[model samples]
Target: MDEAARRRWHQQHSGSWLQLVATLRNEGWEAQVTCEAAPVQVEGTLPSGERFYFRARHSDVSLGIGGDDPADIAEWEASESHQEASYLPAAVGEAMIRRLARRYLEER
Candidate 1:
């Protein structure tokens, strides 16, 4: 892709991460996001003192709580500490963000 296309793609992904951060904050969690490239990252702290994280690149999304030791998102997902973390094809698009946010609110 050209530089322009790459920037557009990054912006799109960053928008998704920002949406997730906003949703989490609206739901009472303290959330923040960083999107320097493909894998946009979100970190949130629940009212109950739990640390939550979310990372996504393209169609791959990973969500988990704790284990701040990972060097990167992929490592975090692969770590045994977050055994439940896994990628799903359904994790793409706006709808997936809503679904994941709902699941986070419901499950966490």
Candidate 2:
């Protein structure tokens, strides 16, 4: 992504991560924030048993949103500290979070 687009994505993704933590915490789950970089893989399983997997690098802070397993969470968290610094505006971050929250809620 271009610098501007990357910044926007970072803000949105960061916001989404924060919202996820809040939601999980409200639901009585223990959540923690991290800033490491970890191998992140997302997969979708269809009703027909078809599965799709995507591999990527993700920040630890972004991975704390949800998961039942603590080990997996910690692994993600441990990778956070190595990420590059972020310099996006707070308002942009907030807006990104709100949009992500809406999308996440709608998906549920």
Candidate 3:
């Protein structure tokens, strides 16, 4: 993808990313955002000390929790906090798919 295509792709994803940030903040997560532009990144910590990291890019998005203490890790391992997605909906045109693939390869 060229520069123009990359910019367009990132712009297309910005709204959903912003909505996600707003929802997280509303849920009482103290969030620190790296940027509001393309490839939005947020690190959040809840009152209970659970930490969350979220990253959204035009090609992909990821969410992860952080726990470094040994006791906390053990407790979490024994806890019933696992979740499975029954369905994840995605709509991608051929051009988008191509762009995603190109971005993935470039990042790697």
Candidate 4:
């Protein structure tokens, strides 16, 4: 689907996105992302729950990076701790988030 379509789909399905997060953790992905735009930071977990968070400086990136592999998640290599502080929800379009979640579910 195109970007615009994806955005609409994502916005309309908030519960689906959250469901994916829980499913990920339960199915072994074990990572949940909390996106906030004010400060531009996205924090989530890895399979082992090794606190992982990254700052999104640009809209061109962050969230999902579509790939040939349905299970291909964006590679994160940063060190920040969300294990203590909390932030607002990210302003990122749900389309991206939903896209990733859909792919994960399809392959799950």
The candidate that achieves the highest lDDT relative to the unseen native structure: 1
Per-residue C-alpha lDDT of model 1 across residues 61-101, encoded as one tens digit per residue: 65565545322432223211222223222234235445554
Model 2 agreement with the true structure over 1-108: per-residue lDDT tens digits: 799997887777666656654664565444433431144333322122222222224222222223444234421222222242243233433344334334434544
Q: Model 4 TM-score?
A: 0.33
Error of 1 at 13 (Å): 1.4
Point out where model 4 deviates above 4 Å: 1-11, 36-42, 54-58, 63-108
- The models' CA-based lDDT, in order, is 0.52, 0.37, 0.44, 0.42
Q: What tens digits encode model 3's per-residue C-alpha lDDT throughout 13-96?
A: 555545555665676666665554444455666434656554445545444445663222311211111122111111222133
lDDT accuracy of residue 57 in candidate 2: 45
Lowest lDDT block of 10, candidate 3: 79-88
* Residue pairs with clashing backbones, model 2: 35-80, 35-81, 36-79, 36-80, 36-81, 37-79, 37-80
Candidate order by lDDT, highest to lowest?
Answer: 1, 3, 4, 2
Instruction: In angstroms, give how far residue 105 of model 1 lies from its true place.
Output: 8.7
**lDDT tens string, model 4, 1-108?**
999997776565444546556665676554544543333443454454333344444323333322332123443331223322222233333343445444544553
lDDT of 2 at 105: 42
Which of 1 and 4 is ahead in TM-score?
1
Q: Estimate each model's TM-score.
A: 0.51, 0.36, 0.39, 0.33
Best of the candidates, TM-score: 1
Residue pairs of candidate 3 with colliding backbone atoms:
none
Q: After superposition, how far is residue 29 of candidate 4 from its true place, in Å?
A: 3.8
| Segments in model 1 whose C-alpha atoms lie over 4 Å from true places | 35-38, 56-62, 66-108
